[model samples]
Target: MIRRHDVTPAQFAALAAGYGGPETIEALARAQLSKHLLLIKFIAEAWVGARAHRDAAVETLTRAQAAAPAEVAELLGSPLVGAWAADCTRRLRGGLRAEIPLDAECNHLSAIAAAAAALAGVEARLEVPSFGGRVAVPGFGLTKLDGAAVATVACGRVTVAGAAQWLAPRTLSATSHGRSIRVTLDDVDPYRGGHHVPPTGRLTSVDGWQAVFAEAWDLLATHAPARADELAAGLRTLIPLQQVDSHSARSATIRDAFGAFGLTMPSRATDLAVTLVHEFQHSKLSGLLDVTRLSDPGATELHFAPWRIDPRPVSGLLQGVYAFLGIADLWRRLLPVVAEAPQEYAVVREQVRWGLTSLEGSGALTEAGRRFTSGMRAVFDDMAADRVPPELVRRAERKLRGTHDAWQRRHQTTDSPARP
Candidate 1:
């Protein structure tokens, strides 16, 4: 269906900014720092939509993607494009409609609207594909029939078992470049057993942790509601994770605790803040991307997003990721300075260096290399400019510089074991 619409400057920027070379969601976030919430909503919807109508949407978008640029350009003014984008995102990130029965007609409306907005001068040849297969949720444990996800808008309305059983409503969305996506789980029980774990080693009471959360909240709340909301909303996602334990994660570099099985309590503010921000970024970032026309390629043969039945070239997703690295790395550099056990500065440096190695290998980093450096430096600059506290910023910067220099010396020495 073709409908008339108009694209805005902001939407145009989002389309351009979402590419991260390899880190789509992170890049998308950096591109829309000014409109973080919008970015979040966009990415989340895209991911979940994709999850819901994996094959149909992918097939639709692939056909749409293959359309002549002249026609694709027309989609900018077509209301159908936005509707499609919204639907695919839902399938990709939200639990698949097969199990949830989401109201994906919502996407038809959205794709049309966004198409009108994102493709202004271009007329898009749009097609709404029919969903007709099993679907899976990207991160959540759920599934549904082709149309069931949209049908069960009320599916997540209530939970029967423990807090773990509680379900939430959310629309997955992301920027066109896939910088990141957001999943807004609805009807959340803020106080739940999932978030209620016995404070572990080094943890005294919830009161102590609450004080830290309060301070972080105070700092976050002082900013835009968008910032506060993302901060709060991001935290809410972690509540159900076996990894609320993730908050206690400490890392010299990768914060692997959250990524794998690790149990430890946070002993430093920087560690706590960085861990929260990183996981938050991951949760949100993962929401917006179109990983495949199926569920985790690692886990299933099913596509999560609606896409054509073919190898969908995610050529741009990684491009988007490089941009995300610039942002995530900056935050990592700015986290805090604490000489806690296993959280040594040297360890962090090796981690950063190891990370840079990945960037170096990616080649996009070569083009975006300068931008990456500038972004890293910006962390300290923000602290000096008072966007962050001087004390926290200063220590973090020192740690980073120390790490960088050590990394350099190691490379100069034996190319092994990273210099001491």
Candidate 2:
């Protein structure tokens, strides 16, 4: 049976104020997991009725479920599994073309079942997907095979014939002041593709990632304990993106793939911390959106966003406001300690203020959206009283106006300014 998920008024307010506790995150996760499971069920039923020859995979998964229900459920709960299932469902529904052969596409479930059986110590042999001599076991690592597409699980061991190497799952962990953060450095999953950029194929050494993540976690745990806790509870995987440059990094979060983000390696831990807080805000809001609709879907009005050169829809504006609110909060906590905190705080806080102003005047907000924005306004009002240097505030205002003028000149329109 599928479970119905609801967000209470208080929880909605807390989440809107950018303060979702672990419990709230877990609730969102449960809702996402349910959506994935329903997709899987729909795919299975459709495949069976159409005689898609997917029974072997279904049988394997059923046996695994009977032997170890929790293990099977856990395997299915992965974000990549959801991505794969969503892809398969789309293909079956004619929304997407069949890129791979139907049988090969359906075999991903067999791969998942094989992983679950291996985890549960159930003996089984199954045909799974092999890409360039590597067979990935979801939730685990990859096993290198010469040319085999079959996986055999016996006596608590999973092996592909003539396998020469095993790449165990790698994770980065750090602990500071009783707070701990651990996340998988996932570079092997083929389904980790929704984040615009492809994953950086398996890393030779995770030493660099480990050191950077530790430093980043220390900063977060020491200063932003609330976000640290949120990360600890919700974040599961980090797909490494190709490095763009020494000082800058790009990151993104997909709406369907909860708890995972694609991020390039940044040179400084401070940048990584800021990126983490910023991207995870997107993740939180994405998860919340899955359970509830905050904006009118039919609304088409576009407004200037302080961070972007182009106009954004009301939904995009809401997402930016929530994300930059977290960024501003992080910088606010780092003030006077980090060398760049003062200017960063002033800039982002001004951006947040600009976004909130636009959002308040937007006519596209639904009832829920209005309440959510009201909660955000309350938080911003509280933070508005926090002191920033007079010089920095002036500089921020100048930059804001300069950006607005540039946008106007480029777009060739004089819409109302996004600022007060």
Candidate 3:
């Protein structure tokens, strides 16, 4: 566990620099702080306007506090921290909601609970019943903890199942196409939902994530073999997954934390394969950014994003470009594999072009961003140089350009237009 005395700014920076690779003790300490401090900020934010949920939130915080050493607890409870949390929460509320989202509230609260359990030298298993008519156990099997807690917080109930005998987390290992990965079903991400507090309903399915993961791996092996190896090498853990139950689309791909990847069980191997590549891109960039800040801290102007409804900051633009670098590569490889599906191929081709154009327009990246992007540009150009059907290129360029132009007119700041 990371005690307050063990962490220094230099150590934290080193950890960020290492990203998620095998790190020394100091780097590991920094990783823990990076993950937990986010949760702590959320907790402090939720404490205000907790109103009806005050007891649950306070209980969650108190338990976490009691579990940690005095120094850690003081850091968590500092008045400055509370004030900061309040300010952040107010901004997050955006005048639309009175309090933080329920799932976020529960997610952070459970993070606190999990930390408390870890500090007490015990392993925890969670059972969360969502109001949405399903129950979920993110870390089902009894497993050793990684100096952190596993907790389930919902309106229904959040309890510690029992202790794991092992001292490290439980893992599932699989190999395919001569590549292997260790999938960790542990409590690593503190801000995940599906394990929520009461009054919410979620459809949580158990006993099937392994099959989905295996299938996804096979698809990668067959189609994008090289990227699969990169994934296997870069990825060390996989968090618990849930079923997608959205109204618009029945599937979702999420990369919430720097290294943590989550997916709604995908039916199509191709879908899963693309998601793996997409989220892996985020993980890689997150690790890189930890070591280096790629933009001025004061660069907070929101800009139009082709993929989003709301304006995004320079950081978000950089992240999008970095992530799409891999996405574009994945599609470039899969293009030949899905040749039979002409319509699908068209979309994939457009994605490649769109990704390239977005990277070209990715504005004013910091020195680090420019350095990283220079390498990305090399690969992107290599892919771009590949000859494609001229008709396909024309069609895709038109479609992608139309999408970007339409999005700007609708979403970009009109009071002061964005640079072309």
Candidate 4:
């Protein structure tokens, strides 16, 4: 097991400042805590809403049951919490109409209860049963989902059963980049719930993903060791890496969660390496945002996003810039490593130039957005002076700006700003 260290705010600030170095495992672990806390906080909010409705229901039930004293009171006493919890689960499910399993429902409530107890800053002596209950949040402490002692906030402890230990039936460890991380072959996402869900695609069997993961890691370790090392240092887990059998490679990266999200492993190692670095950046920023807010909370208006075909909110725009920082950084570094592969080198070089151009058109950010992005300012500025042909740089700039303008013309609304 890796030794856990206390991650400081200053460390996160430096990351937000855009310093180039491998992200310490401790820091990544802290960011993971922020994600769990945020998820817990969300459930707590839902629980509070559910309780409001439940209290009224309970009062009405009590009045009706008053006709029969002993039997009715016993019924009420036993099922009160369970009934309220069920109602809260329904409310939390929202408009999604699907047959949710009973275990899933109970687990959902348990998660919320844990979060609520933590938020209340009180001791939670609740034992929650779950498929895999592992709530290990850095600084906040560890909780197991399985055992009777599910959570103890007073002592900062949580016990999660199946979920924590069950990444995949088949798992492997790879530390080629100087740090160890678990690669899971399962297709089911452990973090699936809330607004997050599994993506649609052909699932890669254990054997398929294992082979793909091997190829991907080999490429990273060989061609982009530095980038690989950075990822190893920061990304401690990979899970439910399902394969999408598509004609072309495609991937999705989510912040606030570790591991790839239905991310397709590309055929080319270079592509895989670049994709890993790109998505990992999103994961890093998500963790950072858990502790620090970059965009104004009130800036809810959607705006044109250069990288995306659709208009995005302030949060999306900020995420785009931050993610592109890593994208550019990867290609900038890889360009030198792939010198022998002229075709690949040229592609990396263009990607770096285009990423910079895209970042520039990312529109106006809030004060925090600007400050947070300041850390990356030097990196982008350095890439600006790269020896790429002036025409290639100009072409990339025009293409990116043109795409943004076109998207705005097609989708911009009265409330939507001209730029993000």
Tens-digit lDDT track of model 2 for 1-420 = 268887777778889999888888888888878888788778777774324335666776777778878777767777778778888888888888855666566677777877878877788788777766677778767877766477788776777777767676689999999998888888888777666556687789999889989999999999999999999998888889876566656899877778888898767799999999999899889888888898988998898899999889999999999999999999989995799999999999899999999999998898999999998999899888988899999999999989988988999998874458
Answer with 2 or 4, whichever has the higher lDDT. 2
What TM-score does candidate 3 reach? 0.57
Segments of candidate 4 deviating more than 4 angstroms: 1-10, 17-25, 34-103, 108-168, 175-180, 189-204, 222-226, 236-245, 339-367, 412-420
Best by lDDT: 2
* Per-model TM values vs. the true structure: 0.32, 0.93, 0.57, 0.61
Q: Distance (Å) between predicted and true CA of 190, model 3?
A: 7.8
Cα error, residue 331 of model 2, in Å, equals 0.9
At residue 42, what lDDT does model 3 achieve? 54
- Candidate 4 displacement at residue 95 in angstroms: 9.2
Q: What does candidate 1's lDDT look like per residue over 242-301, in tens digits?
A: 335444553211111111111134454444544544444443333332211211223212
CA lDDT of every candidate: 0.32, 0.83, 0.49, 0.49
Give the Cα error of residue 354 in candidate 1, in Å.
3.0
Candidate 2 has a TM-score of 0.93
Window of ten residues with lowest summed lDDT in model 1: 253-262
- Of 1 and 2, which scores higher on lDDT? 2
